[model samples]
Target: MEISWLEQVNADVPLDDEWLSSGEQLILAGMKVPKRRADWRLGRWTAKRAVTAHLELSSHPKQLSAIEIRPAATGAPEVFLDHQSADISISLSHRDGTAVCAIVPSHGVVGCDLELVEPRSDAFISDYFTTEEQTLIAQSSQEQRDHLATILWSGKESALKALRTGLRVDTRTVSASISDGLDYAIQDEDRADASVIGVSRGWYPLHVRYEERQAFEGWWQCIGKLARTAVSVPAGGPPIRLSGCPRL
Candidate 1:
């Protein structure tokens, strides 16, 4: 897997039109809001970097503009090279001016999410979280509850991304548990302090899992405190070889 991240983006920074593929250019031109354009560009920039790195590592060197990341009909990201689809699954996330992309060598759907760890109101929790999840958050210490809520929220978002349904499917339908130590391998120097126990949707149990969920907790200077989770959703396909030594 190839994972890439960008801490900040200067929306005012000029974008070289030639650097973006035609499809990407179309998408860029359609964004009317400055912030939206910046966010979208940040995500695409990170994704392109990720794809370039992956291709180089795989011994399939390619130029940046030759690759394009676009949304599939299901809203999951798809990669295209020179107008032809590529054999890889891609996922993207952005929060608080930070963006990340995850690419896998197989068909297993992948999803990732990042969010700043902060306090959430009870009303927000009641509306978005499951009863069991709320109880767990409520039981945590005041200082820990914010982090816990962020983890739950991030995990669900990742899971939903893997499910390719986003938040359109009820968040409560997907649940994730976390531990206090590294359980997965993340590429960055930032170590993950937790692991996702399980992720499910409706009556169908998605065999999605993660070895680690990294919590910023003052470690990430650029984005302050944050939490991130990444998951792999199988599309009834054979398991792809995990690039990093992700211990479950």
Candidate 2:
């Protein structure tokens, strides 16, 4: 698997239209919001770069713009080379000028989510988390509460993405169990009671990973951090490991 990251997208930076395929050009041209356009462009840029790095493609094999990503019927991103589907599974998430792409072999699926480390409201937690997860969070020390809560929430999102439903599923349907050092076990909706959760079903034994990126606090200061989490299918097999953080 390969992970790519890009921080602080600049709206003014000129994007080379030649780097985008014909289908991508239409998607880009149809956008009306400036910020939305920048995010869409940045995500494609990061995903293409990731695909190139994974395939180890030299400039001769293909041009960067030749790769294209389009949505499948389920709305999961699909990679195409010269407008043909490539045998690869991918997941994407971005927020607050930050973007990330996680790619893996087509046999299995993967999902990733980025979130800022901050306090969450009681109502938000109560509505999204199960009773067991809430008890675990309450057991943590005061200082660890924020980090733990954010990570748990991010983990749920990642699991949903791996299932290709994204946030459309109820957050409470998925449960998270954090052990040590950001390692967690996810019992997807399948583990839930069918009658209570409305017959929700998904992959089981999903693995969860947590990582953070340092945030710059001042001109010469970098003190804060952003939390990120990911989940993948075929859980009992080889664990999905994260690579080094990408440079901003």
Candidate 3:
């Protein structure tokens, strides 16, 4: 099935709680940490907007209030419309004021992640990544090391989310690798619009192996210093941007 994705930043979230459902409001009120509350709001806002766009529903605040995103027992976000469960699978990730949501058909499982391309300590690589993943990073040039590491890490997180275990499972249980010989260059024109970032670069195939077995297939792309990855069980097509949602 075709999976759709949307991106939103902190500025895109509404300041008022009018768009949040009663349950969501209660959850927000219970969050004592300001940063956690802000991140939660940003994630919910992005997921609601993505669901509306994917389902072709109204974008009005009142309508959005009826669509709630609640955590399942496994901590995966589940969509609900007017207090009833919606037949859709969604995954969310927020980092550094930016959030992304991935929507897929109900029959399939999906997960997505967004990460900034930054230096990771050697200890981190050894602690979380598989031997092969570390070797790939070590082979990368100094200039590309950060970007490659981010992609691999983000892919692992996405796969973990798809497995519905998140960080509860060992990250090394899953190994991520990019397809061979894929061009990573981004043209100047593509950088002119910061919001569109890597969309123009298109999606590159990513494979994630769980315990040495091929378990999830997905795609990854990078632009500037941002990397996005999405993986799904039963596999999915390259993520298509959901219409009517704000850009990153």
lDDT of 2 by residue, 1-248 (tens): 33232232344234566667777889999999988988888777767666776676643213666898888887788999887888878888776666667777888677767776678988988998888789989898776677678777777777778777777767776766655543221222122222232211111232332222111010000113455565655332322223322322
In TM-score terms, which candidate is top?
A: 3
For each candidate, the alpha-carbon lDDT, in order, equals: 0.58, 0.60, 0.86
Clash pairs (backbone) in predicted model 3: none
lDDT of 1 by residue, 1-248 (tens): 33232222345223565557877889889999988888888777667666665565331223667888888787788888778898777778887676667666664556777787777999999998887778878887775677668767787787778778897877777766554421121122143222121111101112223223321110111122656566654322211212221111
Once fitted onto the true fold, the runs of candidate 2 whose alpha carbons sit more than 4 angstroms away are: 1-14, 59-62, 182-224, 236-248
User: At residue 224, what lDDT does model 1 achieve?
Assistant: 27
The weakest ten consecutive residues by lDDT in model 1 span 197-206
Clash total of candidate 1: 3
lDDT tens digits by residue: candidate 3, 1-248: 78798888898887899999988999999999999999999999999999999998888888889999999999999999999999999999998898999999899999899998789999999999999999999998786778789999999999999989999999999999986422352322135234655352467889999895657899987766678899987786789887663332
Q: Which ten residues in a row have the lowest lDDT in candidate 3?
A: 181-190
Model 1 misplaced regions, further than 4 Å? 1-14, 57-62, 181-223, 234-248
Q: What TM-score, over all chains together, does every model reach? A: 0.72, 0.73, 0.92
What does the lDDT come to for candidate 1?
0.58
Q: Best lDDT goes to which candidate?
A: 3
Between prediction 1 and prediction 2, which has the larger TM-score? Answer: 2
Better of 1 and 3 by TM-score: 3
